[model samples]
Target: MLPLIPYALALPLLWATGPTAPDSLIIFNASRTYHYQAIFISPAGDTLSRERITMQPSGQPWVGQPKRQTACTIQYRYNPGDSLTFAARPNPQNQPGRQPQAYEWRKSTVTGVIENPQEIWMHPIRSNQYAYTEVAPFPQVRPADLHPGGSWQANRLFIMGGWGAFKGSVRPFYQVKAPATRRYGNQNLAGCWLIESVGQHSRLGNSYLDFYFHPRYGFTEMHYRFYDGTQISLVLEGLPTGNK
Candidate 1:
């Protein structure tokens, strides 16, 4: 199946010191749009396909039912997969500030609003009849838990267009590695934390994900590697400047 969910994100750099997650990763300006790039890697480590995706915040969502609006729509230039738009739901505390205290991915659909969406929640152009059950919430790195632990699990539905979706528990373990210096478009990413997932089970098999985040930046980028050795990497190029 074609790749979906650009935000399902991380990376490494040289050893620095203990890295801490920033205040919020989803702290982009709501009125502006930003551009990001994705590099598709082959088993042989060759560039398979590259595309420029656009992220723009709107009152409407791109993948699910239209009743719910005002999400950040991410448009893709390649593949039949439709663009994906998602919103960030602030932490329950609802702290008063320009940056959110904490945020979970949100998608509004005809059935209802889904918090902490899974990959399947965002649909491609040809995908249909998508449904999933949230057995549990995926583990995330919190302020208190600067370092993640092993055996973090979440049960949910993952739908890809090929056969059908899978309903089961997903244990996404984390390897909190040493701090590294990373960058986007020559701009250095500050206080980056690199976390690698051991692997996840799907209808196909086990695959892994590497995530990069900054205490202040939030969910910076991610790389997904399939068992077949196909690697998909998505990175944040720059934060949106303005509505222009």
Candidate 2:
């Protein structure tokens, strides 16, 4: 048998030889600007309208509160060092009267994290509608490490200004279907991870989300269905374009 070594002496050797942590599940390039197309669908399966969305690194931090009565009591801050801003604008090609009233906002910006890369602000129902704000205390949208068949679940809080606050829960299941190929008009894309999340809200009932995420491109496609029969879909127009 080999001679035993002191714990302290062996610790460094063990760490050096141990497996290194895997790469992050998703990667964001602060220098690049991402573009996406948002499609609004009515409960009756009709297409309501479409909007163009652009996501980029924010130069300035974001500070605001949910439009709640307690807005004065609570404030949320998103620093530029670790967050991205998503801006939505009306599509010039859209037909007249095609845009819904809730989607009329010309400039809608939402903030998401760069580390975990999950939307921390805005309701999932409509793009930048600001109907409600979500705060996930656990914030487990995806696993920290990338792998096939990874899954996670967590609780989320929903705060609606003037409508009161409610508690909610979210369970996300992820699966790596196959190797990446030409998708969303982009010939170069990393592997695709499909995630399905089932959410239960204390007051709003149930909601469902099915989205495809790319490590290098972020979310390539997303489909959301709310309790009130509202449905929205977002698809990346193509690979992001910008310096670096």
Candidate 3:
């Protein structure tokens, strides 16, 4: 079951401002767009393909329905109505034999009141292969104080289907690690909060996600390890430039 803490008790701590406070660490700008490069890696550590991804705020309300009702509810920092749209296109120079055209564009809604918001719902805009709707909410209660070593668990209803279908639950146990620098392209991102999680899926087996959130850059990097031994890394490439 999802853990619950009264909102009245969490509000004061969530709004407190400081270098390590949750308010300062979790920042989102709804008006700005984010660009990233998605690198698909094989189980052998070879690069399989690359795609350019763009995420922009839609400024629209959440109107989609979940496959099952959520088990928990809590007030979110961002309006529940707000959503983000994500589109991905194959990089010009992708690996040969890789079908870049298989990539699909998605619209997703995120909800949570702490460091990282869980993607509760996802809809494909260009493809009819699969979708995800949260059947449960993430835990609202977190450490009273935010700092390295702080830990929490977030569980979501994992519902995916289309040509193939699977319905189950995924719970990722998250831990806050010390800030560090990571290299992306020609730039070195420093002072990024390293948040890591490990979880087991009913259909996908075991997996893990490493997320790096920058104080000023928001979500900068995400590394995913799937059960099948495939790894996908998404690195922020900054905002789109020029006419793009």
Candidate 4:
């Protein structure tokens, strides 16, 4: 017991010395139960903080049967006139394996510029369906289009394509269902775009993209549903940025 005392005393100090982000914020939110291992990150791409929160589930009214937890992170440069963007391509881990004879899926890019704390230009490169030619066929606009006047008015959610031989043949697809404007009110910018029409073969294939914006941390809630009944839901509540 005597040697254990020293180890216990050092435990608190070890956690205190853990790495943290430079100047970012993190929020942890739960829907069912508290999770001690929850982690939050910042837009500067750093771990801001971690916390545990108690949660209550809506459907099942058991003592502790269905417990759930979520985390959120924000990263942004604060230096005056500073700018940055986040980008990621679907890797083998998130996409189906390509056959030698099959046409490979090109990497899609989405760019967002930090403009104050109120607005951002989240632009994406548009392309043709069959030929893969860029939509804007001119030298100035063919490669990319930077829509600067836009703002990050809603949550951002992405669905990952799973790896399997049958995955490619299952008809990759995705959809976005907007809520009734009169009931929910049109508040989010991303939600305003209804996905009524989508190509047969799409990255969002058979996936549901859903998210809601929070005040402090921008967008927090995210839900992605796959065709085979698998779903991933995440929520970041109590973000320092207050909601509308």
Candidate 5:
């Protein structure tokens, strides 16, 4: 996957330079008119990647349907200040009378960073409201594993709360719990969600997501910063509602 570039950095890069196609290239199966590109540096120097991403066209509604996409990693040596373009293929989904443009078509720049970028959700509250006490499981795992939580079984009530906000309001937040027995990798003990609340009049400002981590049991730590400068948190008092 291509690294995500903020709106701030993207405009400048697009203005300066676009990717140069390399001799060695691989094209994936995609819908007609699909157009995407990427640039990276390896031992041999720099290589550019391009693909035509496909999507199932409109028309069928009764049976099951699936969209076309691709997932693969581009191997490249790491370097700071190096920039790469992660642009998507053109709009094959766009035809006469159909939407004239493809919203999914995107372009992003990936730049190496020393410290990982910071993330904070604008909205803190969840919409599916539930307050109940239930016996939570425990797991055994190592500390870092315990940090992301996976492998073991511990006892605590897994309480959760969520809601949605306006479009482009904030990013999503997610986390998993650590098990009692310190074991291996971060596992089922973790999860994530993006909440968006939409309606007229009682509009909630858009764009907010919160980050959290679990260790031990009961309540996982909440990590989100609000625009109001106020922060809020809660423990897993009980299993909150709305789960599949």
Candidate 6:
């Protein structure tokens, strides 16, 4: 058995560690539950849907420390009419920081396996549609890399062409604008930095853009506006609670 750490020593260490962004591009609190309120608008600027769901870590709640031979499967309980598992990785290893490396993100549907590398912070994270087997590099931003006046290029890899003629497609690179700090209710976001990133030349021009994050919560909110003037905003409705 391992020796137990004394309270005096452990307390300070815990304080020193504090809260940190996960190495993976996506900001997820593996241990906590998040409540998100989503408001969707239609093409003619009409309200479409309002959804509120609590994301609970349904399986393998904690991702083991990086660099080990572990089958890291981070699953979240999501209900979109049916039960779903949000992510999977047969093999996961510890990566440096959230800057240059990435892990895998997956979605399993009756059709086939849709896997994409979770690198830079970009999304629309290929849903469970069409058997797109080719793994693509979806690039964007890392939490540690976000700061005032800092910008990063978004270059995602994807498959293009017809249904049967699926060919590897490299989307055009675009820039993501990061705010130095976001002000809320006449004040700046305290305790953590708020960064919003958007894809400059996304397909719908506005869709698949405006990904937001907070260091403490990793993507506390996301604002998406489609080319047709439809607006959808997702915000964290409460504080995260978990085993930690």
All candidates: TM-score = 0.53, 0.57, 0.55, 0.26, 0.18, 0.48
The TM-score leader among the candidates is: 2
Clashing pairs in 6: 66-94, 67-94, 120-140, 121-140, 121-141, 148-180
Ranking by lDDT: 3, 2, 1, 6, 4, 5
What C-alpha lDDT, on a 0 to 100 scale, does residue 144 get in candidate 1? Answer: 37
TM-score of 1: 0.53
Q: Model 3: per-residue lDDT, tens digit, 11-80?
A: 1122333222222222333444566676656567876556555555333222221121111121112221
Model 2, TM vs. native: 0.57
Q: For model 5, what is the error of residue 142's alpha carbon versus the real structure, in angstroms, after optimal superposition?
A: 14
Clashes of 2: 1
User: Residue-wise lDDT of candidate 4 within 79-119, one digit each (tens)?
Assistant: 22111111131122323445422223332321111212222
Report the C-alpha lDDT of model 2 over 89-150, residue by residue, as the tens digit. Answer: 33222334444222234354444332333321112322233232131122123435345555
Question: Alpha-carbon error at 100 in model 6, in Å?
Answer: 41
lDDT of 1: 0.42
Candidate 3 segments whose C-alpha is farther than 4 A from its true place:
1-27, 65-145, 160-166, 183-188, 239-244
lDDT of 1 by residue, 41-145 (tens): 656787655666565545334243333222455566654321221122222223334344322222322221111211111121111111111111221443433
Clash counts per candidate, in order, are 17, 1, 0, 18, 44, 6
lDDT of 5 by residue, 165-197 (tens): 111222222233422322112333433321211
Relative to the unseen true structure, what is the C-alpha lDDT of residue 94 in candidate 1, on a scale of 0 to 100? 34
lDDT of each: 0.42, 0.42, 0.43, 0.24, 0.21, 0.36
Off by over 4 Å in 5: 1-125, 128-165, 169-212, 215-219, 236-244
TM accuracy, model 4: 0.26
Residue 104 lDDT in candidate 3: 36
